[model samples]
Target chain A: MIEFSNWDILRNLLLAAQWTLLLSIAAFIGGTVVALTLTAMRLTRNVVVMRIVRVYVELFQGTPLLMQMFLCFFGLSMIGYEISAWGAAILSLTLFTSAFLVEIWRGCIDTLPKGQWEASRVLGLNFLQTLRHVILPQATKVAFAPTVGFSVQVVKGTALASVIGFVELTKAGTMLNNATFEPFKVFAFVALIYFALCYPLSLCSKYLEKKYHVAR
Target chain B: MSLVKLDQVHKYYGDFHVLKGIDLNIKVGEVVSIIGKSGSGKSTLLRCINGLEAYQQGGIAVDDKEVTSEDIQVRRLALSVGMIFQSFNLFPHLTVGENIMLAPTIVLKKSKQEAEKTARAMLEKVGLGDKFDRYPEKLSGGQQQRVAIARALAMNPKVLLCDEITSALDPELVGDVLKVLEQLAAEGMTLILVTHEMNFARDVGDRVVFMHQGKVWEEGNSKKLLSEPQTEELKQFIGAVL
Candidate 1:
């Protein structure tokens, strides 16, 4: 067996944590773009477009993210497009994150008073203009806390990417455990690293919730 | 020439008729007040004039342009017909000046400086010039309602429709909002209001229209209508409220 020093394990895990962080950021930004489009489509009065978005949301949200990752990584290969593990992880996580974010943001938009829509319409603003100028400004305040809170979920979700062969923090911890013959110590360190990443985000969400509570 | 004309206008909410066969006309600078019991359709008639609620039958013409469901026509009508609500629907997120300036800058395509100038002027007109930079939540109910008025006037509407503008204010606060309306009337801005304040209606309105069960039941000189009721329904309404 190879002798693994504590510093070596930590140093290697720390190096792998960078991949986890990068994946989380990628999922968040990509998810946000797709979610915004989905939200706009959902808001449209078109029945077909709304139904299509609804089906997309349900397909992503109702299934396991792990299953989605498997489909992206292995199922795509079956169809003859051998996607890289990195690409598959991002694609699956983005779809997963967007499904949730769109629902959360749509709830925010729904919370606004109906008078807001009427008032903006009476002011001669079109649907898009009304959304940009009036509805979104208010919805953003309502959405901010919940949105930040959900980021913690995204960060945690990156751990699941390991099953598809992406060498993130969890994967690194598993490799470290195999080499060190110390599962408890290796996993404890991994958990600590995740805590370090997620705790501050949790605090930020709480702060925002407190700040905007009076307005609600 | 009449600035607003509603000809046999009818509105329904899923077979429940809310406004039934209403004909009304207002000349430039006229101040008309509508009063009725709850569910009397006073608010519905006012909303139809601004295209906030579409009438199922008949026609509404503001500034000689017919109001239609077409987006551009509705928007054009909106330019000439401003509306204020009882709830004072000022955007809570924006400051008073921004609330007032929003339409002018976006819809009218006015420059920021020009819109700000107009917003400040309207705020001053409503006696809340000092509150321009403040958010709606910071203001009292009366002050917020005044900001809503200023927001509407920023469009330079030829006619203003006010649906129970003072109904949501605290008792002491109602006077301040009504006083602003009185000032607007004195300046010859054509105003139509649905109000619960019988005294303000008598004092400020050129005509008081009594609406009952989705129709204009009776109307005449404001003082005459209040002092001498011709219909039994009007008599009961006056007795109940006053």
Candidate 2:
């Protein structure tokens, strides 16, 4: 058996944590783009398109994130599409994050008074202008706390990506345990690193909750 | 020719009939007050004229442009018509002047300096010249309602629709808003109001429309119509509100 020191284990885990951070950043940005597009599409007030988005939100939110990873990784490959583990991980995480995020944004937009929309529309502002000036400014205030809080879930959700052979914090922890036979230390560091990554987000949410005081 | 016209307008919410064939016309520089019971279509009628509330059947024309559900047509028609609401729907996020300047700057494509000048002028008309920098939430309900009026006026619409503009104000605050409307009427700005102020309708209104069950039951000179109730519905409406 190879004799791996504590520093060696820590270094390897730290290296893997970089991938974890990278994946999280990519997923969050991708999720934001997808969620914003979906929100705009829903605002058109078209029945068929709205139903399609509803089913999408329901489909992603109803199923497990882990299952989504498996489908993106193994299932797509089984059907003859060449998908790398990194690509699969990012794709599944993006979908998962956006499904919840689009709904969260919709709720924030809904919290506004209907008169806001009507007032802008009656003033001869088009739908896009109404969003740009009136609706989004107010909705963003109410959306901040919940949106930051949800990012913590996205960070944690990256852990599930390790199951599909993406060597993130959790995957590194498991591989190190097999090599060193010290499960407690490796797993504890994994948990600690995740805590380090996610705790700031939780604090940020709390700070925003207090700062904005959300007078809606 | 009438400045605003509604011929056989009908609206429905699902299966429930809300506006059942309303026909009305008003000349330029006229102030028409529409009064009715809660479920009556007076407010709905005013909304239909401005294309805020869509009607399934019938035609409405403001300044000869037809009102429809198409976004472009709605926006085009909105250029000629302005409306205020019962709840004083001022944008709380923007300062008083910004709220008034928004439509003019963006939709009407006025330059920023030009928009600001229009905003200042409209606020002055509403007696809030000094309140241009204040936010809507910081002002009292009456002040906010006045800001809403200023916002509508900034568009320079040919006709203004008031949907119970004073309904949400304090009893003391209602007079200030009504006073602003009186000034508009005096300036011959062409105003249509949905109101419960019998005294205001008679005192300042050029004509009064009494709506019952989605139809104009009785309408005549404001003073004569309110003083002599021709229909039992109008008599009952007056008896109840007064």
Could you list the CA RMSD of all candidates, in the order they appear?
1.8, 1.8
Q: What are the per-residue Cα lDDT tens digits for candidate 1 across A120-187?
A: 88889999899999999899999999999999999999999999999999999999998888999999
Off by over 4 Å in 2: A1-8, A214-216
Task: Determine which window of 10 residues in candidate 2 chain A has minimal summed lDDT.
Answer: A207-216
DockQ score for model 1, please?
Answer: 0.73
DockQ of 2: 0.81
TM-score of chain B of 1: 0.97
- Off by more than 4 A, model 1: A214-216
TM-score of chain B of each: 0.97, 0.97
Question: What value does the lDDT take at residue B155 in candidate 2?
Answer: 93
Q: Which numbered prediction scores highest in DockQ against the true structure?
A: 2
Cα error, candidate 1, residue A187 (Å) = 1.7
The whole-model lDDT of each prediction reads 0.93, 0.91
